[model samples]
Target: MAVAAAFTLPLVVPARAAAPAQAAEVAAKPGSPSPAFKTVGLRTQLNWMQAMPDTMPLAQMSIPGTHETMAFYGTAFAEAQEFKESPQKSLTMQLDAGIRALDIRVHPQGGVDGDRLHIWHGAADQKAELGSGVLGPLRDWLGKHPSETVLMNLSVEGTVDPSYCPGQDTASCMSGYFKEYVGPGKQYASLFWAPSVQGSSRAETPTLDKARGKVVLNVYRNSAGNPYSGWGLNYGTDAGYKAQVQDEYKVGTPSAITTKWNQVQAFLATTRTKRAGNLPYYNFLSGTGIPFLTPSDVAGGGSTGSGDPTDPPTYFTGVNERALGFLRTDSGERTGVMMMDYPGYGLIDEIIRHNPTSRAGTAVEQNGQLNAFVRASDGNLVRSYLPYDAQGTQGPWVQETVGATLKAPKMAGNPVATVRNDKTVDVFYRSDEGHLIEAWRPPGGTWQYADFSTSGYAPATIAGDPAVVNHNGVIRVFSRNPANNHLMESVLPTQGSTAGRWEKWDHADVTGAPQIFSSATAVVRQDKTVDVIYRTADNRVNHSYLAPGSSWKQELIPTEPPKGEGKLGEVAGDLSVVAQGSTISVFSRDAATNHLTESLLTGGVWVHTDVTAETNAPELSGSPVAALRSDNTLDVYYRSKDGHLIEAWLNSGSGTWQQFDFSNPVYHYAPPQIAGDPAIAIRPGKVSVFTQSGTGSHLTESWLTTSTWTNWDMTADNRAPVLG
Candidate 1:
């Protein structure tokens, strides 16, 4: 294992651009709202606890958590979380990414006789039963990540159960449920870091070493309407390990977030410098008092509890966003247990980074060989992969389902995929909401998401297809600023920042304003110079290049090239580019003639070929996708005029080009009726293509081997559920 040095955050913090406040309103308004930014998810601190010394007091460390964690299914005013999904799946995402505290409230159903516990948020039912939704997942997480411990504040959410106790023996009645599910001879009971029989030890706070793999219970109130002294750690008053609290949950309105933040910051300052024995500080950052400033608004600054961009921003910045800014500047501070709502936009990772013994970062990486991904009808992303040195089929194998991002209201276009030298796989696309979303997976891990457009990370409003080029480990994502039809770029923050957000620069503009272009494609050379080609609005092809540490250079391909000298060679649709060593290949459709044209870039010279005319290929109906083999042989596939998949191939050494039709019956293979365009992937001995089934919307796949073209495929229906 590599020893990681402590990470220092960048001096300049990235935030949404603040709108200039009107001079007249400065005195009248309580405060001008902070610049608004959308919620972009980052990698969680999965095992930071394992890096901490076991002897450290859990109370002396900073812990990130959610308040009313499962209260997401109710009226907008009652909902407390924005990661909308089933309780188990939502909770697990938080847990895997460094959340250690859970604030759960449950109402006992069927009176005092039944063990069924229903989750609620005041007047609304949250659609979850305790045993299955909350406890089961927690136990499972502790079992898998045994180096961690959980602090749960479980309280009765309703009045019916406690009222059923007849005002006497409420403690005795509650003891029965524990004995049934978590009592003597029950394996679970031993893992509960609670007194065997609560007495004078009601306020014991254990060290991480003593409570590893255990649930440290904290009871808010008792069934008998008395102090919860007999159950576990007393969070109220008058206990040896009593909690020092700062829960200003009723901040009046959304604009009062600054006031609430000042209070939280002042409290944390004291916890780090002062010594109050081993007493823990339970600083609750969750607040809501008005309908407009509900929990959703105060958390991530999104209105209506929806993370999508269609919902308007809450003028005032959210607590989660602000907290992230403050926490990044703090070092080795004991935040105690910092509870919040809508734990996103880098909120969880920022909180865990304050722990003294942590090696916290903003990314999660794993080791795996092959993977596939797609967008589901419900707007979720699914993944499937094969292990290294293993046999596997191209699939819609659906390992993990990444839900709609907080910034994207709707997913649009096909996902563009790439793998870096470090084996990090990423899928980029533009959302129908004019946002650019990146769905990336770490080695051996599931998909994680980030949206560049939401935080004003783009130079202009993003729309249309987005292009990505990876040079070494640095990735550059490009999108056209549809407002002015100018090409723009946002570079990944791979150094000097732990925020994991992409940053945009003014100098990256290719085809500046007033110079209109479409369907831009990018490719990187061995020398690290990037080349981008786009079709001019006038139907001519233009090429631009940018070398490292140099200014942008521009060129135009001759409209009447040598390959199709007597014919018009204007680009009509998509531009697909592939760079092999010293040569670059670009495929496009002729605007005047529906024929596919191949343009090659080599040694600063341009060579053109009309593949459709040369091979007698049928006219193309959809955009074409090109792939390169180890030997530098290239193959391009597109949907034909008659709806069949047509492939055009050419060998590097030979100038000859050939055509293959998957729809031909002579090969005797069953190929699904493919709709739209086709995608290609190649390994050492095999090459494959995937499409969407025109009839039932299933994902269709076809491939070829050494001696003959052979294929096996899977659709979205057959993917195994491997993620929450």
Candidate 2:
């Protein structure tokens, strides 16, 4: 599975749930706002949720006095019944507002001659029926719109009144009724697309195209009696249903509701990961038992203790509001089916947005233009070019498979590339055999390959990606020897020397093993010294360097000690280093907070600073990348917590930092989700950034020209692109 960032949203707990009388008082207040209705229009996308029409409010469908039995149970029971989970709108209304997942509790009652299935909520006062009430209308609507799908979870709930199921076994009767009314033989049978229950695991649910005008019937229980058992997906066990409030009548406090909501969120977090070949995940974001709050409570009811009826508690406004926060924070993890009460309150819009999609990894730029080198899905190295004309107008991006004849395995780490003095590009990646493979192209020439294992005394296995840099005229490639975890260096032959060959340095650093997921970053100082920074196994950022021709030396960048006495938590991701004049700044993500932290190597000491704190931005979602602009100012780019691209820059003159959101305005349709660390290149007034789109993992580029931003979809599924 592709590693991606998980979305999470936070929920705020209210003070308390209002008493029944207080709720009534709040609802009766004059000048109360009119009830809010479902308003999200029909969806243009092809998804079960997007295609269904709105549903009628649950409250409007229930027959008055239907809750008499529950009310007879006492005050607590009666109060719970008052908190109506159903909305006032119809199914079509909810569908219009974006409700795709339906929670139906069918009781064998309310059909013609009193022998039919009716939608039941365990309340006697509520009326139920299959055809005109719910199933029939749903079928009719689906017929009108064949491009949509619905997930209907039919379960036998409430009392099986003999008047409703007069004949055989109740479960079998209900199942037979469903088949007779909505099965393929029915008038709307063509609209029923029974997803195969066998081999359901690993089989992706049909896409919108395949599921259009289809009903994904989920027989929650009594599947043995379901005539359509083999036709639709069914789970023998009731594992998918999660109740937000186990005893709705007892949930009288807002904190209790908050706790339940958190439970649902936690359940989703874990279940999403384990959702392989299982029944679709479903979340019931509605509360039961507490009956004092009605559908009107959502928008009108006041707090219990507060006398001002107009100041109603938020819990009364709608359960959907409580769920919005979670959905907002949901990081596109697969949220199978989210069922809600009063869903039209804009909650469905948020849920629909959390659909997960693949995105491209890191990206790089070359020759002041954007160039991406990716290991294709087929294990081929591919390059994409986004060329800009002399007029500053960008051209269409072109992509080609590079080193196609090599038949290399998919690279384990992002490929790194550097430009030689002859303008040739040298790209380095670790081959499947753990050998460091270098693919280079001479000016307008075909690519050539060199294997380090065959060249010299290089280690047969390298643990991670290699970093390359051009020092004066020599091309130095740095990697980690997996055997001893020691840093290794191999130097490519100088520009035009036919006698020169790739050779490994005789010495290995004693800085311990570098993190397998991190690669060394090399920067050459004006004084001819080469400085390389990497994370050590001890969870410390170590700087290893060679002063001119001096022996290699390693030093740990000082970090703030932990509260009691333990080393700082492990570094979260890779380290980025950039040098301007004599100042070298190293950027890394703090494992504890995921915030961007910086260490300045000035003089001979390292000073630590919290870069994100100064900028007041959220914790970064990916590794950070930095580039030195023409003005000598430092510009850092990183993905924000929301999967949008953000840039923080230092004002060269004032030395103050400012941040900008690069993804919101232009890439809002699909934010630039950094699958890998982003790459940056600078030219005069231009700053080009390359990132992988989280939606499709495609190569995406955004550059700033005179403060204006322009973007391009460069290529698809390339490991973070590197600039050469």
Candidate 3:
């Protein structure tokens, strides 16, 4: 219920989330960390996220974060953290105790340098600089322990420099100042997840693999509407990146402590029941109400039962004490992020305990097997499977051919493969006369083919290769229409009378979309929306999404109005769209430059990039094939101008474009003999591309093994029919 609930408050501290900082601002620093601080994480928890896989997200874990982390220097009412005199050092101690998120409020002095800024607990200046006092130490800690990631909930405290008061637009001003320490050659340049925050972060949540060794952001944007272009994940106000927070700081009086504690308990209960989502949850246990309840009164319990007979008694338990008791007594899972004032007295320990010690691997490994298909010179469809290899020897892959010899139909042009949701492998291609020829093989079943174009299933004909996707056992194949160049859809149902037929030719998505000049590329989004990307006759890239229970919506790339200078180049070759988690990427070739191009879709918007321009990759020939590795690496493979198969890859480690030319002669990996285009199938540790051999009628497969690329001729090795 994080983002699902309404964002009914302000964006910053003045609202419910940050208003607690404004409560009881009487200046007075607190004592050192509680006696319980030294008892937590004696040898463990220092690098807790280290044990978690990169695939795991902080949203899924229960983290302990400090509210007004550097607030220990201010007065008792203003302070949020413990260990005065050197609160920055206390930060290191908290990090050691499994505290991952920091609610850091900075008082911007409005200068070019970060040191001019100071940490503030409301109006009280904590006397801490933003640079060496805050980020500098965090950078050093992450550098030493690259596996551990820190989440900084950055915000503006009381006021900013008179020279640059952003007023309600503090998000922009804060991000602008942060730019000085990031980007090329800066100290904390690579300290944050660049890609996650690049576009509208609402598209998805940040996974640990993308956040480790850096400071993840929970930016407090005090503005109207969604803070789409700012830093960190939004509070799920208008989007789904929910950071549900409960910071009810106004504990009216010390006697009202139970009320404050109830908010903490309620937030935990609500978020835990709804914890199935992939959004970070915040539960603030720090609060103070000016004249009645101070910071100390709210966290460590205030005195009760008046000796002066005027009032008989005022009974309440400190929020932290209540939290420890409730969390210790209850065995509920997922406490989310426990943002606290004084996170000691075994409170931090209890919160950290909710995190999973070990999680099962979550990659979508397809039965640990690779499957591919190719067209033979005899026009027969040949399917290959790497099921523990031919002799099941040492993972060294071998081919198993199934085709015409087994009643598979003859086809024209290249054959494309699809792994349906039912785990069945199906390949489709066009007949010489543009008929729909489909071949399907069930798990451990014999190969089969049906000419749907003439079987009363589909009446339309395909002019080129097809893009196939199976959503929930419903197969949809989109191909260019031979007559008018419009992409046509042929559906195969898993049930009812249409189960065996490739029927349903007129899909609302295709019919509503404009005519396309090339084969359509389609991918199903995480939300089950089928997004088909194609190039119009005018050469501009376009997208059409089919959301359930709604009409098909089509628009040009970037957006309808096209906000920025960003635009997808004129596509000249076949487009390939791939869906990685919540991200959809369409790969194409720039018409004028023939450079491998990519248009990434996130937050319902597109951002274009020329791979050749970004990486200086050699100009590509024909079309490009793209596949995302099991390790989150995106690879774009294409035929280079020099007749070598080129691979351009992008991963977080390098954070840049890198390449490999298989036929460079230096790697000693022979190419597939300079083929037209390729089909890629990726499993756990390897990426395999099926291509047509230039010599003879061989269907060759090229794959990588550790440091070497291996190219094999399936036609010759398995005595299979020749490829066209």
Candidates in order, TM-scores: namely 0.46, 0.52, 0.47
lDDT of each: 0.60, 0.52, 0.61
Clashes of each: 5, 62, 13
Local lDDT at 147 for model 2: 42
Alpha carbon RMSD to native, model 2: 15.0
Candidate 3 lDDT:
0.61
Pick out the ten consecutive residues of candidate 1 with the lowest summed lDDT.
1-10
454-569 per-residue lDDT for model 1 (tens digits) = 77777435644667766556677766675555667777756676335567754325434223355466777656667677666555677776777887777667654443232336
Where does candidate 1 clash, by residue pair? 366-443, 366-444, 367-443, 367-444, 383-399
State the lDDT at 3 in candidate 2.
9
What is the per-residue lDDT of model 3 for residues 204-236, given as tens digits with 9 covering 90 to 100? 567666677888766644322234454567455
- Using TM-score, give the best candidate's number: 2
Residue 319 error, candidate 2, Å: 37
- Lowest summed lDDT across 10 adjacent residues in model 3 is found at 1-10
Relative to the true structure, candidate 1 reaches a TM of 0.46
Candidate 1 wrongly placed segments (more than 4 Å): 1-368, 388-398, 404-409, 493-501, 506-517, 561-568, 668-672, 720-724
List per-candidate RMSD values in Å: 19.0, 15.0, 23.6
1 versus 2: better lDDT goes to = 1
Candidate 1 local accuracy as lDDT?
A: 0.60
Q: Residue by residue across 1-724, what tens digits does model 2's lDDT show?
A: 0000010011121111111110110222311332211223332222223211122111111000011111211233222222223332355545544455565555564446423665554453345365565565567667765545666655565656566456776655655666656554465455455543231221234444355566655444442323223334534423322321121323355445555566556656654445334345555444543455432233122344454676643423334454554443332234556554333333444454344211233333445555557665444677776678879886566676775665545554467777777767778887656678888777668878877766663678776567777776678788877566677888865546632567686334444434333567777665666778877654478787777668677776656432211123346456777765555667787754566776666557565666676678766756677766655667788766555678887775555667877766654522434444466656667766766654434566777787677776654433233211
